[model samples]
Every structure is written in C-alpha cells, then in structure tokens.
Target: MKTKLSLFFIAIISYSCSVNQNKTKQSDLPIIGTWELISATTKEKDSTFSTFNPKLKMIKIINPTHFSFFQHDLTMGKGPNPTFAAGAGKYTLVNDTYTEYLEYFIHREWENNKFEFKISIQNDTLTQQGVEKVEKLGVDRIITERYKRVKN
Candidate 1:
C-alpha cells in the first residue's frame, strides 16, 4: 500500500511539472500578433534620429516560417480609414530574427525591398531593429528603423 501511494504522489508531481514546462515553452514563442509603432530610429549619414510618432501604427501576423507586416499612418484620420492607408509585406523568421521581403505599391509602381533584423518582445512592447535596402532613382540605399508594439 505504501508503494502504491508513493507512485501516485510521484505521478501527480510529474503531471504538474509537465504542465508548467508547457506553459514556459509557450511563453518563449515569438510575439507574433498585431502591434503598434511606439518609436523609430533612422540611421542616415552616420547619424541616428528618433522618429516616434503618436499616430503611426503597425500589425504583424507570424506563422511557422513566414510572417506578414502591415503599417499605417494614422495622422490622416481615425477608424477604418487609417487601416485602409497601409502597406503590407511577407517575411521569414529564423530563431529570434526576421527578414522581410516586401513588395510595395506606390504611385502606380511596384517596388521590391528587403529588411533584415533582430526582434524582441517584453510584455506588450515588441521591438524590431533592422536595415532596409531599397532602390531609389536607380540607386540602392540602406535605412534602419526600429518599431515597438502597442496593442491588438
């Protein structure tokens, strides 16, 4: 009887430990969801500047190997109108880093761009810092931007 009781207690403790482990693993997953822009820093000509906007926002949907980013300028208006004026792209995340291969449409022209960077999340704040390379006027220029998560 004592042996049976010891085995039962061990089983209970093993089950509880497994449940806690699963929760920890889930929490370690990347922060992949709708996020907003809190601030940004642009590196240009050996100088960096803070570019945080109170009206700019973004959302990201991350799947296993691919993710999508949606950015919008909210200074224009509120509600659905702001979301309508947005840009989107697809990307891939390896480990804790992400690379975006974005095709943007503007002024009746489509432009291809690439962004590579590392990402981190602390509570509701998600930060992404990366370099973006784009062709402008037949020349390639590299720009860096950092984003912070806001809300759903």
Candidate 2:
C-alpha cells in the first residue's frame, strides 16, 4: 500500500510539471522578428490591383504596450541592382490587435504620406489592413498585406 501511494503521488507531480511546461511554450507567440511580404493588394477608385514582384520586409520589436515597425521594399530596377524603400514608425497594441503609425523617409515618393492600420499576428503569419492617403497623388488607397515570418 505504501509503495502504491508513493507511485501515485510521483505520477501526479510529473503530470503537473508537463502541463505547466506546455502552457508556457504555447503562450509565446512567434511575432518578434522579420517578416517577408507574400502578397499585397490595393484598391483605388473602385479598381483593384496587385503589386508585381513585390518584395517587402517588416521588422517588429514587441513590447508590453507598444511596438515598432521597420518596413522596407525592393524597388523594381532596370539596372544591375535593385534599390530599396525604407521607413520606420511606432505602434500600439490593444486586445491582441495592433495599429501602426508610419513615417516615410527613405522613399522620397512617399515622404508626405501618412499611414494608419490594424495588424493581426498569429503564429508565423501577420496581416495588415489600412487606408493610406497620398497628398501628392490626391488619392486614397486601401491596402491589405500578408507576411510570413522569415526563419532566422
């Protein structure tokens, strides 16, 4: 009877430890890192179009209350090498949703544009939806993009 009771208690302790370990591992969301754009679609003036050879990357630094967005795109080039478009901004997360505020710099064409959007991060996928207005072009565009985490 004594040996049986000892074995039962040992099994219960081992099960409790395994459950806690699994919960800790599951709580860690894989969103902190670099993500490459798989696709992007935009709607403007009742017309929908997609970007071709659209190579874009975004780096996100996760924080307790907010985060940062570092975005860059590979510009289509006719020459030997491709150019890049880069920008940086900050964001806030509420209820597992994020809103990014972008400030353009590296790409002169987007210097005067401001962007605001909500983002959803799930496992290795990140999705963003937002409206962007370009003062120079006098156009309002709706943007939706999906990114997959690039393995380090």
Candidate 3:
C-alpha cells in the first residue's frame, strides 16, 4: 500500500511539472494571428529615423511554427504586381524574442536571410524591434514596427 501511494504522488508531481513547463513555453509569445502594420520606422545613417509611408499596407501572419508577411502599395485587391516585398519561413519564439529563417522571399536578395527581433504585444498591438545588425549603403539600419491585431 505504501509503495502504491508513493507511485501515485510521483506521477502527480511529474504531471504537474510538465504542465508548468508547457505553460512557460506557450507564454513566450502569445502571438499567433494576423496583424496589420501601423508603422515601420528605420534608423538612418546619420542617427536619424525615417518611417514608411502610411499609405503602404503591410500584413503579417503567424502560425504555430511558420510566419509570413507582405507589403503592398495598394490597400485592396490583387494587382498585376501588388507585393512590394514579401517573405515566409519557419520561426521560433523564445521568451520575448522571435526569430525567423527566410525560406522564401519575393526578393531574391533576402532569400535565406535570418531575422531576429524583440517582440512584444499589448493592448491589441504588437511591436517588433530589430535585435540584429542590418546594414545598407555602408550604414547600419535598425527596423522598428508596430502592428495592430486583425480580429476576425
């Protein structure tokens, strides 16, 4: 009888521990949905910043282990060439950090690129700030974006 009780308590403890670990992993980023870009800012060479035109529409979709985003100058409908830029790949979320490996991209230059960002979501909005070095024209550029969750 004592041995059975001991086994029962051990099983309960193990189950409890597994449940807590799963919760921790899930809480890393509760970011699994489509989001519309509110703004995208880039730090310029001279330490200045430039934001994309508000008229440009960008959308991001996150799934269990894959993600994709696309930008369009036209806000609606399919065009002969609507995508300004688009990419899709597998992604991993750890703690507050999100990383994506570019498996496919409209622009060939970005193919196989890796993107690391500090991700945070609050009040129906999501923010992603670049945590990796991105250079252009011999100047370091940083990307910051704010997105609003699209409710279906």
Top candidate (TM-score):
3
Superposed model 2: Cα runs more than 4 Å off = 1-30, 52-81, 108-114
Candidate 3 on 22-127: residue-level lDDT in tens?
Answer: 7736445679999999987887565646576776788999999899999887756464654487889998888888888989888666667677888899989999
Q: Candidate 2 — which pairs collide?
A: none
Scored by lDDT, the top model is: 3
Off by over 4 Å in 3: 1-26, 75-83, 131-139
The candidates, ranked best first by lDDT, are: 3, 2, 1
List residue ranges in candidate 1 displaced over 4 A: 1-28, 58-85, 107-110, 137-152
Candidate 2 vs. true structure, TM-score: 0.58
Every model: Cα RMSD to truth: 8.8, 10.3, 4.6
Worst 10 residues of 3 by lDDT: 131-140
- Model 3's TM-score against the true structure: 0.72
Q: What is the lDDT of residue 3 in candidate 1?
A: 100
User: Clash number for every model?
Assistant: 1, 0, 0
